[model samples]
Target: MNRLTAVTLGVADLEASAGFYSGIFDTPPNRDHDGVCFFPLPGCWISLFPLGHLAEDISPEVPKTRSGFSGVTLAHNVKTKDEVIAVLERARAAGAAIVKEAQDTFWGGFSGYFADPDGYHWEVVWGPMFDFTDDGALLFGKG
Candidate 1:
């Protein structure tokens, strides 16, 4: 199978979500359609679609909750703890709610969490033990 290429969020307001994400990522949508907007990530991308439409697409999947954690999170791993703080700050300034403040972890990393306008949780982190490829992508390391 091909690599996972995108993480799509079901948003309530297209324009608002687009604006908030564009500011947080410091980039505009690479593509925009009648009800969807696309933001490019390093090896993947983020797609925003209306919550109703997204629900329709996944309607067959039983037990789709309307609110709360959604049992998923998207992570942004940076090279430094400072970068983690900077990202959380940027998210706060872009109208995100900082769910967790950046702090040192028992696992030997620094991280924090934020929720976008659409309530999707994002974790920004810096792990000393993490391995990354030359292109600035995360590598799982040798098996």
Candidate 2:
């Protein structure tokens, strides 16, 4: 219960979303089922399923339509400030809209944001206080 294994985004178009993610991830999906796609990362997986179906799976009470902000953001951390800009540009080229340009953060870091085709916000960030494990999982704090 303490660990997060995956983050599933309910997307509008399965094929388009899959393609968009594949392009930015630089790899094909590890698994594609009748209604879902999965991309495996270093520490977890990103799953995409149709919005309506995802809502149905949750419960009949959940709304199928999404609007405004979902109050959630996915993040990709980089090793340097330059890499943050690079990743944001890459995402833009892959069909994401640049929601926020790369800039310095009040916490003494660099970051920016982009909205995916499904309107999901992804933050590309670089923090001096962050590091990575040998296998590439994002590590917080310098201890």
Candidate lDDT values, in order: 0.87, 0.91
Model 1 CA lDDT for position 109: 89
Q: Write the per-residue lDDT of candidate 1 for residues 21-122, one digit (tens) a residue.
A: 998888999664777899987788899988788888878663334677779999998888999999999999999999999999989889999999878999
The true-versus-predicted C-alpha distance at residue 103 of model 2, in Å, is: 0.7
Candidate 2 Cα errors over 4 Å, as ranges:
none
What's the TM-score of every candidate structure? Answer: 0.88, 0.95
Predicted structure 1, TM vs. truth: 0.88
Superposed on all Cα atoms, model 1 deviates from the true structure by an RMSD in Å of 2.4
Q: Candidate 2 on 50-136: residue-level lDDT in tens?
A: 999999999999999899888999999889999998888889889999999999999999999999998999999999899999898
Best by TM-score: 2
